[model samples]
Target: MYQNLDLFQTSGAMARHAGSRQAVVAQNIANADTPGFRALQVPSFSEAVKNSGVGAMKMTRSNHLHGDTKAAVVARVIESAAEPAPNGNSVSIEDEMLHSVEVTREHSRALAIYRHGLTVIRATLGR
Candidate 1:
């Protein structure tokens, strides 16, 4: 299946992780004024890939060898250890906004990679 393809797997994973992270960032911003609410975070892209159980891979290009020919990603939720406000809320709107921008960029990068991969396939097939 296409899911096993490193290109697709990594791209899909990045998209999914970015989407989930955006949701969590929104949740944090929504709770910014709530009492006892701690800011939440999703694992970084690299960490997500590591946690997703995508094992190491090796390849042979005649006399050349390759590693990690495949990749995938997933995320886990964790609370930030930032200093809490007097009201027990740790959410910072500024930080959340920055995180939001980062998530958007990652999502776009993922989509671009997937799109280019498909384009390459189409060109190769002369379709």
Candidate 2:
């Protein structure tokens, strides 16, 4: 049980990030018709995964891939709301919805992985 704690913690973090991403996406969609509003986007999430650094799983890549550093992942998602908006509104509902769905799915997947790990641990303990 204690050994599986890390996985749970990591998954919780990822889920929190996904929830944050969803809120940003929702904001973008809500502001789509508002004047002077620019769409907000979530930063690179795969980079976040790499930075989690659980290090239990390794990627099988032929050429070495420059793994993302933890600092890069920790950086806050800054809103670049300076895009030129002809109608004073830069948000796009369709795009925001699509991105939100994708992020939510990823969060669910991560939770599933965490649950599976816990199940395995429980089985090993004969619980």
Candidate 3:
């Protein structure tokens, strides 16, 4: 069904990444006061989508690598923890809140686009 394609074909990947980001931010916020806790963040979805290239790639490595030779969109979490704090807690409330806002906006936008796509596909099918 068109809904399935919209959910699984295109939006699925973005949704997954968004979920990861939300989790990362939530974790950071939860550990804001925990000593030695390292704050982490998921990179932007736009960067991952852009890096996925044209969907095909030529493996030029002589040694076998453990990933898809062809670029597949993936999400990565990088430590954004601040430099050493006296109490070892590096989490910043302001920063975490800002990141949460950005992630929420991106997720909503992607969902909207995905719903629109499904609508178009359904109309074309006269469903």
Candidate 4:
């Protein structure tokens, strides 16, 4: 009966997204000194969800809905829009540090959501 619970799925997705973003930030930092290496970034969680059509109608069969099915919410890495330095490298250690902090917060928020959801479920069951 709980197989369709979206709360857990959402929290998990959020956590996964944060992890992906963190990886990209790490990559950017690692290449900070590489000439011509542009910084990379992933879109925000909200944008990813919106573009993926997470809550949209699904097509069980090709002809079922006559529309596109929901796409997987993937955290795609894109080239950052930051201006490149004289060496042609775009990564800024300060910016990457800030991104790391943001990713940490996002992961923590996801965990809190999942934990609170479990607590609410337990309370509902009088556990």
Model number with the top TM-score:
4
Task: Tell me how far the alpha carbon of residue 36 in candidate 2 is from the true structure, in angstroms, after superposition.
Answer: 0.5
- Predicted candidate 1 versus true structure: per-residue lDDT over 15-123, tens digit per residue: 9999999999999999999999999999778777677657666543555566654444557899987799999999999999999999999999999999998888889
Q: Give each model's clash number.
A: 0, 1, 0, 0
> By lDDT, who's the top model here?
4
Candidate 3, TM-score vs. the true structure? 0.76
Clashing pairs in 1: none
Per-prediction TM-score? 0.82, 0.70, 0.76, 0.87
Q: How much lDDT does each candidate structure score?
A: 0.85, 0.68, 0.77, 0.89
By TM-score, the better pick of 2 and 3 is 3
Model 3, runs deviating above 4 Å: 1-8, 52-71
User: Residues 1-127, candidate 3, lDDT per residue (tens digit)?
Assistant: 5544524455667777788899999999999889888889888888877877624444557575543455556787888847747887778888889988988887887788788887887898899
State the displacement of the C-alpha of residue 33, model 4, in Å, after optimal TM-score superposition: 0.9
Range of the 10 consecutive residues with the lowest summed lDDT in candidate 1 = 63-72
Cα error, residue 60 of model 4, in Å, equals: 7.1
Native-to-model Cα distance after best TM-score fit, residue 22 in candidate 2, in Å: 0.5
Predict model 3's lDDT versus the native: 0.77
Residue by residue across 22-123, what tens digits does model 2's lDDT show?
Answer: 888888877887888767766646666575553534334646465432321342466645454688787766667778789879789878978898799889
RMSD of 1: 4.7
